[model samples]
Target: MRVLITGGTGFIGAEVVRQLVAEGGHDITVFHVSGSQRRLADVADRVTLIRGDVGNISHVLDAVKTARPQAIFHLGAILSTASDLDPSAAMHANVNGTFNVLEAARILDVPQVLFASSIGTYGLGMTGPHIDDLTVQRPLSFYGTAKLFGEGAGNFYRHRYGLDFRGIRFPGICGPGVRTPGAAQFHSWVVEECAKGRPYTIEVAPHTRVPIVYVRDAAAGVLALARAPRERLVQFNYLINGVPPTPSAEQLADAVRARVPGARIDFRVDPQRQAFIDRLMKPVDDRFAREEWGWNPAYDTDAMLDDFLAELAAHPQRYPD
Candidate 1:
């Protein structure tokens, strides 16, 4: 199976690439923007690297034509903070970029396109105890708006052109290389910073809880969705809570301290930042994901923390603070 992954060099994308290569037999192509294989250091030699911006239709089309992929994993996007900082750029990258990928798949007769959607799609403000597949998609940010639009567009392309479009609405994906600026940064940063013996502060309150998933689980969810029998996939996109029991900022801090013992962590809740963080961090129900495609996340919050710190510990040089 020849595969092409857009934004394959990103944090989650890198894990996706690693998982794909580990499976073996599939020829992989990474279409990235930075042209830097820094995140893909492990599997760089195994996969073909192609430089392209998703916003550039021509570049995407060329990459698609070359890869002629049986499955296209579209993971490229402008994230939350970046989207707020520059919505025009976000629109170009997120909205227009998705369009380009779908269009390329359609024109090139690519059979399947697995999109990376987000929890941002839900318009439901204030994530409460329960959320299911039927939640309304009224996005508050440009990033969420673009993702929701992409989901609809994928649905359209699926029904209209028979493209095997599948997607998962991800929670805060926590792992190494967590550089995207946002309140959510604390989720990954707290663990990495603690593991590196560096002091870090959270702007949100200690009790602010957000849904999260380990990077590996997130990647696996995508792969599982893609590999599921099409006949079993009555869902266009499903919400995937990668880890159970969304930990609060306080819980996260405690976990790090327990693991590292000498880890430094503090909190200074910022109301402004907390506004959107609250929405994005809201709890998510993934029963649909689990039932529809066996989307079982191996890591719960505690397990996720253990592995996250362990990974950082294994590679101290990679996480120097």
Candidate 2:
């Protein structure tokens, strides 16, 4: 399969690219901003990297036409912190960016589109011990709002045009090499910083809970969704809870301490930031994803932490202080 991945140099996109390379039979074209190949180090040679902004339809259309990809992974967006700082940029990158991808797919008759949505869609109103598949989306932030729009728009495309658009609602994705400035990103930041023997303070509360997925499992889940028969998909997108029974900051920090001895990880609860995340922190039921497309996480918190530390150790060059 020929694949086109926007934001292919990003955290999750990089892992998705690695998985595609490991599978060994696909031509991958990465549509990234200004051709930053920094995060795409290992697989850079294998992929055809194109410089383009998804916010610009022309840039997206050009990449799609050039790659002529049968499968498109639409993953580019301005994340939480950046979005909070300048919502206009988020609108441009997240809202318009998603639209451009859908338009390109529709215009070119692309077979499939795999979108990366966020759990943020179920914002402040998600007051529950558990968030089921039927929860309504009332996003609190500009970032979440744009993501919700993408979800609704993708579904519309699927229904109106038979566009094979499928999406996954991700939580706080944790792993090494995440440079984006999202509030919840501190979850991953703590782990990565600790691995490098650097002291760091988490901004969220010690006991605040949140959904999380390891980078590897996140990428695997997306690929599995793409492989499933479209007929099996009763809905256009599915929720994926990577770490169920969602771990707390303290739990994750404790795990990091246990793995990386002498690591110093502290915290202070920023009420504002914590509020936004807490609103979307309910236990997400991803049984739909499991039954629909055989999505299963390879690592639990324990397994994930172990591998995280090990990977950082083996590839210290990957994460510099």
Q: Predict model 2's lDDT versus the native.
A: 0.86
Indicate which candidate wins on lDDT: 2
> What value does the lDDT take at residue 122 in candidate 2?
81
Candidate 1 on 1-321: residue-level lDDT in tens?
Answer: 899998898888888999999999999999999766766776789999899889999999999988889999999888888997999999899999999999999999999999999888776554456666787677777788899989999999999999999988888899877878865778898887777668988999888987788999999888889899998877779998865677888988898788888888998878898886765555677788888788888998788887887777676544444
Which residue runs of candidate 2 sit more than 4 Å off their true CA positions? none
State TM-scores per candidate. 0.95, 0.95
Q: Write the per-residue lDDT of candidate 2 for residues 259-299, one digit (tens) a residue.
A: 88899988887888888666667777888898888889988
Q: Give stretches of model 1 more than 4 Å off.
A: 124-129, 316-321
